[model samples]
Target: MRGPHNIIRLIRTGATLERTGAMKVILDAYEAPRLLRMVVRGVVWPFQWLGMKGDTSMPPATRALTALGPAYIKFGQVLSTRPDVVGDELAVQLRVLQDKLPPFPIDVAKDSVRDALDVQVRDVFDEFSEPVAAASIAQVHKARLKETGEEVAVKVLRPGIEKAFQRDVDAFYFAADVIEFLSPASRRLRPRDVIAHFEGVVKGELDLRLESASASEFAANTVGDEGFRLPDVKWAYSGRRVMTMGWAEGVPLGDNDALDAAGHDRTRLGERVLQLFLSHALRDGFFHADMHQGNLKVAANGDIIAYDFGIMGYIDEYTRRVYAEILFGFIQRDYKRVAEVHFEAGYVPADRDVDEFARALRAVGEPIFGMDASHISMGRLLSYLFEVTERFGMETRTELILLQRTMVVVEGVARSLSPQLNIWDVAHPIVEDYIKTSIGPRAVLRDLAKTAAVMARFGPRLPGLVEAALIRQSEIEAPHNRGGHRKMWALMFLGGLVAGSGAVALAVVL
Candidate 1:
């Protein structure tokens, strides 16, 4: 089923693009190579009749992607933030896919709610209005709780969305296989691993219960963060296919006119958005991965309210330190330190020359430093950074994909609010502060404290463990060797203890 169906799906995907007249438009926007464009056109053109004829009213690219399914729409949403990659005109057209997709019927949504919660809409809500917002995976209905009489947003999964996403993802897996098999150079990017990561994220999104938990955790993490908040998740009303949260009332962050009408300071809002994202990423190690305009809103008091917690990004403490240091290095224009950090983190191959990599990194960081806020493009910088890393034989770090993508999207959102927003200026204090806290003497003491706690827990059992180890070693040796083995083991244990103490002392000195 996968082989035949995936081939058909791939052909139909191309055919749909061709039939909707988007094939050329997309290629031109991406500036695809002449030979590659010709090859793509040749491949998809012949199967035009097999494709779905998307709505003729919308733009070609939008229509084709909408007709494709959820996965394609999600891809379009990501591209909408990258006007530098897809071009402004096409990016504008694709932004409509963010939260403007046609929603499923109210009856279907009600049935889904009922199925998920084992209760009728009337049983839980005093009034469940028609969907107020809709996107690829889910739709939200404005509802009032019957018991509390409080307004809440009820999010319901689109009917059959799981199967649709699974189908498209299967096709994507097949396409990745084909690409890797035909083009060995593409293997470094690990196309299959990319799809697998996408699949894992999407699967988590498909279950509303996970989204509920994510929202809860995010709310807890962001507590007391100034001018930023997440809607409170209504746990009792949440289920696998349905989630409810306190309604967020505000103007959409994308509507500049509305924001201006509300008298919000656009420049301050922009800086706050960027600063908040950095704070969350560096300090909390968890953030709203989808920070695009559609998922963000501006309250009247200028608080940046984020919802749609289906996708969140998390890195461990060590990765967070690495990320903070990289940002700090770039801000200081110390390309050599940046290159060293990459190698230290094993991001670049050990065999690569550190000096040469530093030179390449300088080529990337230097050009963007002196540019005006409006002139600098984070998206372009990231694209160039990718090229440099690839040349240096750095493999794609799957864990960082969400963080990087969210950064680009958050930058776009901030720029929309303030065209002259200086990203580096806003990010500097946050990154520098994080470095001072996480990597300095305080951090060393914290690590030592944690280590001491672990050692303390195991302290009581040390003698018995050492005795058991000696007995086991003596059993493995001969009777004649017992005395010599015990003396050697005692010396080795003492040496280890001395080494451990010396290492701790060295850590303190450093």
Candidate 2:
């Protein structure tokens, strides 16, 4: 429950957003009853007279969220990936939620870095400079290390941004509550869960150390991976509020003229973009979730350098296998198995007819089959697949949704590099290779070796398990036992039975 002080802050935040035309933006995007919109409008009506002139309508949904603040900007970003909840048009609009915040004062940033890392910025860094870029969450400054003189990028958290986020997220939570109350049917969309996920994302991103750790983890995951690389994290200078990383220098993927002027191979880079993204998602369980053009760069050597590790996504091995099978089924043009995988994975409800789902999936995959590399559009195929998912009543999978949206953005970025590049052509080979290597006959032997290694480690514990069982048996015979020998014997017998059964089961699984 919110205290009075927090409630007051919520009201003020709501009024400010309303005054800024954010309320109207939501009202327009979300089609609720006219009466509801009007009623809500009536509540904020008094604010228009409070020294604010006419022409109060703000920018579109994307720009409005940007205007609202950092937290709302993140909300817009999340909604961009959630086409099922926000509808296609609004989700498309929300993709423009880029960070264009004005930089904080250099003194403030210096103080923040000093306080966060518990040292003078000058002591650790030489020629520390003003921020080159400012986002809603943080800003980055270019600097060189005092010890090694290695150029590094220093990112400092926005001062008091956490409190601002808390207040705004409180308002978001309140709105979510009202949404569920007013429209019970929307509960299936999991509005509260979505907000909770949004809240978690923003909160997690606030801690710079998490981002640094993600960068290191991602770097480790893609050590030998081709065409994709992560900037090295400077652990000594990074902390909860301040992060330092190896300076990344490359033409951003968005810079068409620069890319063309660099004389890079467009066809290869585009295919690499698609292939790298798929490999990241399917091969490495982790992916750089925010892979927009701004966060990616094309190095001089033609490798892709990714920045902004704050928003990473992970797909566990089980989901990876299911995903691979689904892709394999689609690649093979076996829509029935694709549908069956969904049912087998319980993604589609059992009551749903498998044949109907197959036909639906066919509708998504068939059109792109015979198209040449230049003609096929991966984005359109994914859009169709999303449509099929909605029609089949599949609930949202957050990880997969992020993957889907990232793929769209990546494919878009790839298209910018090579207008005629076929994404599926690049994706198909990568997915096929992964399926063959990780999910085919080779995987069986790999699993057996892994199982053998696991058993080798656990074999030492078997004696300990038998010793513990014997201890229990001895306890059963103790004359002064609390439970009495009869009860103890039953427990001992049951424990022994379970242990023996488990050993047999482990043997069979191995």
Best by lDDT: 1
Residues 199-256 of candidate 1 have per-residue lDDT tens digits of 8778998999999998888888889899998889888888999999999999999999
lDDT of 2 by residue, 1-510 (tens): 565655454455456557666666565666666667776667656654442221234345654566556887778888888876777777887787667788999999999989988899889888788889999899999999999989999999999999888877877777777767876666777888888888889878998888888899999989998877877998888899999999999998888788889987877877887788788888988988888889988899999899999888899987999888888888789999999999999988899999999998998888787777776765666677767877788877878878778878888888887887766667888888888888888887677666556656766676577567667667656767655666656766765665565565467565
- lDDT of candidates 1 onward, in order: 0.83, 0.79
Runs of candidate 1 with Cα error greater than 4 angstroms are 21-44, 55-62, 75-99, 377-380, 461-510
User: Cα miss at 450, model 2 (Å)?
Assistant: 3.8
Candidate 1 accuracy as TM-score: 0.85
Q: How many residue pairs clash in each candidate?
A: 0, 0
**What clash pairs does model 2 have?**
none
lDDT at 470, model 2: 61
Runs of candidate 2 exceeding 4 Å displacement: 1-25, 49-59, 370-375, 453-510
Residue 122 local lDDT, model 1:
97
